[model samples]
Target: MALVEVKVPDIGDFKDVAVIELLVKPGDRVAVDQSLITVESDKASMEIPSSHAGVVRELKVAQGDKVSEGSVIALLEAQGAAAAAPSAAPAAPAVVEVAAPAPVVAPAPVAAPPAAVAAATAPAAGASDVGAHDPTRPPVGLPHASPSVRKLARELGVPLEEVRGSGPKGRITVEDVQAFTRAVMAGEQTTRAQAARAPQGGGDGAALGLLPWPKVDFAKFGPIERQAMSRIKKISGANLMRNAVMIPAVTNHDDADITELEAFRLQLNKEHEKSGVKVTMLAFLIKACVAALQKFPEFNSSIDVEGGGDALILKRYWHIGFAADTPNGLVVPVIKNADQKGILQISQELAELAKKAREGKLSPAEMSGATFTISSLGGIGGRYFTPIINAPEVAILGVCKARMEPVWDGQQFVPRLMLPLSLTWDHRVIDGAAAARFNAYLGQILADFRRVLL
Candidate 1:
């Protein structure tokens, strides 16, 4: 009898994906290439296969554990079977196939944040990172949480110590903070942590100045199927809730004349057809946004710890994220330094990233670090949409399908392609005047690409 360690094969570019399910337990027989544990990346979920045929001695990985290439998955009893030694990085990576539960893709966590945009980069320290940005917070000793988790707690006004940790080593996760808020909103003050923020004049103080969510069973009304949301939708749903609830968002809708811009795009596609690069209107939008951000730097800023939640974090560099709709769910893939790239390059990168997004192959680095965001329903066709602002980033630009309509060009009526623009900004940091100016300037750029040059 030989005891051999079962390690995760090369997962390729996925250095730290969550183990969502364990397919085998101790004493279970596993054949070579048999799926062992399921790990989920932010966009796609895959099953890790066993490298050897053996009886499982002990499971080394657990659900919710983060595993990477060569991470031990289990210990196996080889039973005198001769198995080739596994390489440090296997020549062929673990196959990325959707498991039985269906592939998971949350809107952001559980970011899997646009809190992950902040939290994913945060230090998983044992102590709270709250004191760094929040000067006027409560005096209670800090709880063990990542900086992003602390940020979510501060925004929701939740006491971290009160929320139970479900992560490894009792680390408070973003979901924990969200769950605490949901509990309070449901009129269940299971703990006294929220007492400090309780409304002064309240009815019995049973809940946090809110009514509980009504529990419902929809089956009585019609036929129902219990469909699970992709892991992306769950994570993003949490991220969107945090941002939408915390930020004082305001939307301003306007239209851009993209008749000439559309013509230019068509021309670019014709010229680049030989090179296999097709230009999209989003490329022009990205460039136009870069110009608008330059003209109104505050639109590219974030509300932060500098002013004790009253200040702005002005980003000098421009990184723009665009919402991409996938069969799984909606994901935002970003373009770094839009100001540095041309229309052709942006379009090329856009194609590559969008392909990766559609294939569920986008990495975290490609999705995070967006200073601003754009959500376009152009291809899908919509007049206007109010997009939620991604946290840390104060503004989002929403674009809709362009339509041709008669316009009064001073003397006569002319057909012009009108592209609807919706600019949503955090009212706390940006006033109505600034939001209007940002949208107006953006329209001006789309109307004439020459404005981007100046």
Candidate 2:
């Protein structure tokens, strides 16, 4: 089979499932078992992975579409034998039709000799071919199209530049290129400006309208050694970049007087010292956050972009995730149901979760399903710093070093331990006034542990 229609796989006991997200778009190359879409039913949300490695030719379902078992989700150009075999002669003409948009040589005929099999199966191989992906090419400056679209464009002899993009931010969609080809074939007056301003694969920074990323030889000035980043950093870097760029984030800075709270914590530890569970500040913070979440439910909700980007999914359960610094990188271990647990229980759970995180033994379930997160740098001695909001959760609390500073108590200055709080939130979900109030209320709760009871 040259092309395959990817259908919804066996989803036990679910029907008319709403698509929550589309992970792969038309023209993207996908690996076997790679997630293509996320569907949410009443019971749970699950990702649908590709069963075959191939290039996505067309998306049959979009976000918010209700799909059932055997529903065609996408069309794919199967890789390897399914795509290259001479026995697939029946679909050769259709394959040729899809390739009409690209400027590539034709595949060998069905009756070609065995010696030409490899050449027939191989994709076009011109380094300058816009459809032929050049590994050395700087991917940033080139026209945006999926791998399948580029392949189709190559087959159709359509330079992507001549086709005006109708997709988001001048992105060339498959339809756009196909329409351009139709116009050209109909003998309509179409300008071939693409040939004049052709993208030079790796060297065309002018296409993206941005300065090229500076490449430097640091070894020339000083001795340098190359070291690979840790697995956690490498993975988290991409997520951090996407979140930072996409989210309109705002950080509200505040100070919490933990003078009395710290003393109470020490007393609690002294009281439970023999119990083998020491109460930590993070436990109290978790409890305080849960309380705040209950009071301000909006802060505990996620904007459902999959649901048309206008709805918020309010979570009733409070699962607090705390950032743990391991030798590898930062990891967050969520304490499920922090709202139901006492300080001692929360502290014990946090300790176990932190231990598991440090050992890299934390399960996926342990790290997921968090309603809120806290990143504390109090141990490392930072005054204040903005923390990135972990997506799906609208906010993150960043705690910094607590220092004993003199405070004017109406008449005299008294030394009080002030813990710095940096609350970062998505501006789309939270206003400045609301964020300020939240930070203030959090500080108030920390200043007087009694407020938690009230």
Candidate 3:
């Protein structure tokens, strides 16, 4: 039987997407087009499907490892029966031998530092002589561990070689990696000791200049259980950190009188209830934002990274992304051509996308190409929040609960519904005056929907 290498398919412009889950293991029979692993970018999560029907021989990449298109993800032993089918089967590629050994030792409990853990768990590109970022060739010896253990190590950033395995025949276990990381972070292990275990300059997260994360044994205080972060959090966290650090953000808070808008929305909802198209505040918000964006084209632009951040790419069309909360985490599903969409159409699509997001069914295309974003906390009852601007979009609007407030009208105070709005923008592109004007304009449009025509 011929062995074939399975690679990642075309996943669009994203690079270095993290492998989040493995769908198959060695000895498992996989059919053509079956998912082999799930990889997640900051925008969306997708599964890599198998191109050939075969038995899983070995997985090449582990969860937490960043991969690009064409990166080998697994090796498969091609099934002979698959060749006889009418469909054109993928041709076998070069063969790579994978060592299969049964575990001989039981893993013991342990903990370690994040970088050391990543080093210990993630496979190096080369042996002791290889540089961390070298791309010349493959590493000499692969680490020994199940895919799940390898994944855990990658998440923790532990080098498998540095971690001492307590499992049979010195097989590394999750506890061993954790113990190693704790020792490294707590300064129990010297720099020399860490260097000896893994090819060391420093661990993965070492360049941040931040002090080592404090290690705490929560069980010492009370009953405790460790739950791993969801894949969405792991992927989105990095993007959030980057956006927060690289972008100089400024947030402006304002209020919009939505009493009339709310009444109109309710009337529309009541009228359309039988039509099955429900009206939502978000739909109106989306339309109002589109009007503001049209008035201020600079707010509908992104910093062109390839242009050394000196140029802006102003989108001619309006595509808005709304943050949707799900069981997994927050995901932004973009509504394309929002400028051309009516309130009812936008509301229907928003509901559909939100449903898909909650169900984890949103595709990568549905999550990309947002010219601007809105994070609404109205349903959850928050007053205001500084929403991190979704790069490379320059601005994001945060919406909060609407409340009845006393408004001064001429000589009398009257009750009106006021909606809180928090507009956060990149200071590099938008100054305080522009941001203030943008917010004021957005508020005006929301207060009186007819203003959108101007």
Candidate 4:
């Protein structure tokens, strides 16, 4: 039997991935392609599969251990050639045993309870008991604990019922169980005073003072400590800062007359309810942008070369990315072939992508490949703000809050829903006039709400 070491495969551009789960253990038999461990990066989670059909001999990594490409994950004992091959064996015949008949006995009938017999003979109660237990009684194992305590207990693998409380009404304090656990693990006598006075570390805190506290002296300390940037954050930060510095970004503010667009959204929503698609203003905006791009193909194009070798690269297909805020950081999940998808389809896809992103479930594929981007802070309070262009994409459209503002009509000022559009574009490729023209065309399309529905 040959023992083969299973090392981590090359995941593109990812390093120091943390092992999140161990799918198999030592001595367990695993088939080829069966998952051995699961690792998670900031962008996505992936499973490492067994390279060969064998028994797991050892696991080199544990949960929370940071790993990189070519890191040894486990050792597998290869199955013998004889074990791998199938044997052609005959089946065994079934045998039946015969038994002799014995003396027969008459069985006695069971006597029913007097109350039950009376109930069957007479009328039943308004609500018969029928062997039912009382509904008013609380269910078993349901402890009287606060939600916070329950959450902590679940995280710490501590049973709430087993923990002795020190708070009001027998409430469990976080420190109480943590101290108990430390004492037990250390094999030390559990003293109430010592447990209570155990230093609460790990979190950031300062010492209390009787008078005014002295300020921290940075001069007394050596060199400051610096944390390495995460892969996603590092990329995002560098790209954003580079875009800001390199691009002469300009913004154009405009409002779409979405009265008819709103009505159309409501109408489409009624028809698409069974399909589970929601028609929102953003859906219409995406459609409008796509249509406008088709009319002004230059806007969809990118400036490939600067100065000496000046040329524009016009993309044939539209892959618009939507910036999604995740727990880890901001991620831009692309919507491929946006020009081909209808408003309803776009809405459904966007919803799914947003849901996955927020849940930290977006795959790495979903977070890459974009020709353009759209970022909306309309859900928040901002009216308008310049958005940084995502790298490789020439421009990013920013959507701000839509508010009811008085606008002057032909006769008088009327309250209309106004949406702010802030477009930031890379100056290396796109000229100011071209950018203004692109924004103007998009504005016109949005203002003509009937065009969007059609």
Which numbered prediction scores highest in lDDT against the true structure?
3
Model 3 per-residue lDDT tens digits across residues 1-454: 7798888766767689888777678887665555677676544456676776778899999879999888998898887654322335332211111222322232364564333244346543333533222123443233444444554566555566556554432344455555555454333432333434543111122223333234455788999877889999988876786577657898999999999999999999999999999989999999999999999999999876544456788999999999999999999999999999899999999989999999999999999999999999966798888999998799999999999999999999999999999999998899999989999999999889999777
How large is the C-alpha RMSD of every model relative to the true structure?
15.2, 16.7, 15.3, 29.4
Q: What is the C-alpha lDDT of each candidate?
A: 0.73, 0.72, 0.73, 0.64
Q: How high a TM-score does candidate 1 get?
A: 0.61
- What tens-digit string does per-residue lDDT give for candidate 4 at 319-372? 888888776678888888888898888898889999998887889898777887
Residue-pair clashes per candidate, as listed? 21, 16, 30, 0
Q: Alpha-carbon error at 113 in model 3, in Å? A: 26
- Candidates 2 and 3: which is better by lDDT? 3
Ten-residue segment with the worst summed lDDT in candidate 3? 91-100
Best by TM-score: 1
Worst 10 residues of 2 by lDDT: 90-99
For 364-393, candidate 1 gives per-residue lDDT tens digits of: 999999999999997788888899999878
Question: Against the hidden reference, what TM-scores do the models get?
Answer: 0.61, 0.59, 0.59, 0.49
